[model samples]
Target: MQETERLAEVRERIARAARVARRDLADVTLIAVSKTHAAETIVPLIEAGQRVFGENRVQEAEAKWPALAERYEDLQLHLVGQLQSNKAEAAVRLFDAIHSVDRPSLVDALARAIDREGRSPTLFVQVNIGDEPQKGGCAVAALPGLLDQARGAGLTIAGLMCVPPAGVEAAPYFALLAKLARDQGVPLLSMGMSDDFETAVTLGATHVRVGSALFGARA
Candidate 1:
């Protein structure tokens, strides 16, 4: 399928999922993950009216977004990968939202960066929902503390983000993330990906990051 065709399909799927959940379609934001893809591939989607995108690396986004941002109005770039503390300032300046804040040290870095740059991107604290050792999110038990630190540092905590274990059902993890968001007085939830975004939307995901479904398999 063509990129525009795929964009239409994903939007339709999101609308259907929202309708089934009795949620307004406007509540869910679709973020097309553009990491690993070239600008030539991304521009077509932009021209097709896709405004929100997610990238995995600061350097990669820096290389492409500056020029793209100049041409496109209201383009929202998001950092959806694990962020290194050293890159906090660059991430703050470039992304409109960040989905991988998980530790106190990183929070401190972001706070300082925001102060210096005078720009605050929407922030989500990623949780190790499945307790995967190799993952980059904060442990479940450490959530409260991490949140406190983020809030204390004057960061606007948008909500929580999580990546469920691959090749398994993602509903439970999405549900748990929702519950955690509620418990912590957060109003947004960023969860879901190419394979399970519909499920994520049904379970109260306010944002879904979809890549392969829209861009085709990455090389």
Candidate 2:
């Protein structure tokens, strides 16, 4: 499908899913995950009214952000992948929100980077709800301490972000994330993706990152 048609179709899917979940369409924000696609593909989607986009790599984001920003000043870029502490500087410079901050060193680096840039973007602490050590997130048990530290450091802690375990059911993990968000007293819950966004929305997800569902295969 052409980009315009694809954009409309994705919006319709969001609306339909919201209806199925009995949630207001306005309450669910769609983030186009434009990670590996070229600028040519992204620009059409932007022109089609997709203001929010997601990128996985700090380096890739750093390279594309300048051009995207120049062409689409209203674009809101989100860093959706595991962010390394060393890449924090470039990540802060390019993204409007960082969704994978799961370590103290990463948080500290982000604080310093934001301080240097004089811009503090919204941050979401990635929680390894399934307790996957290989993942780059705090284990669920450690979230409170991390949340306290991030807040004490004056990082704009908007809410929690999580990626449910691939093989396991997503509902329980998502519910746990919602509980964590409530306990932390944060409002935003960035969860859900193409396959399970309806469940995420039903569980109070404020933002759903949909890529393949919208843009088809990642080229």
Tens digits of per-residue lDDT for model 2 on 74-168?
88989999998988888888889989989899889988999899988889999998887777789888898998888777787897899888877
Which parts of model 2 are misplaced by more than 4 Å?
Answer: none
10-98 per-residue lDDT for model 1 (tens digits): 99999999999999999999999999999999988999999999999999999999999998999999999999999999999999999
- TM-score versus the correct structure, for each prediction: 0.99, 0.93
Predicted structure with the largest lDDT when compared to the true one: 1
Supply candidate 1's per-residue lDDT for 218.
89
TM-score attained by model 1: 0.99
Number of clashes recorded per candidate: 0, 0
Model 1: lDDT of residue 113: 99
Highest TM-score: give the candidate number.
Answer: 1
* TM-score for candidate 2, residues paired by index: 0.93
Per-candidate Cα RMSD to the true structure, in Å, reads: 0.6, 1.5
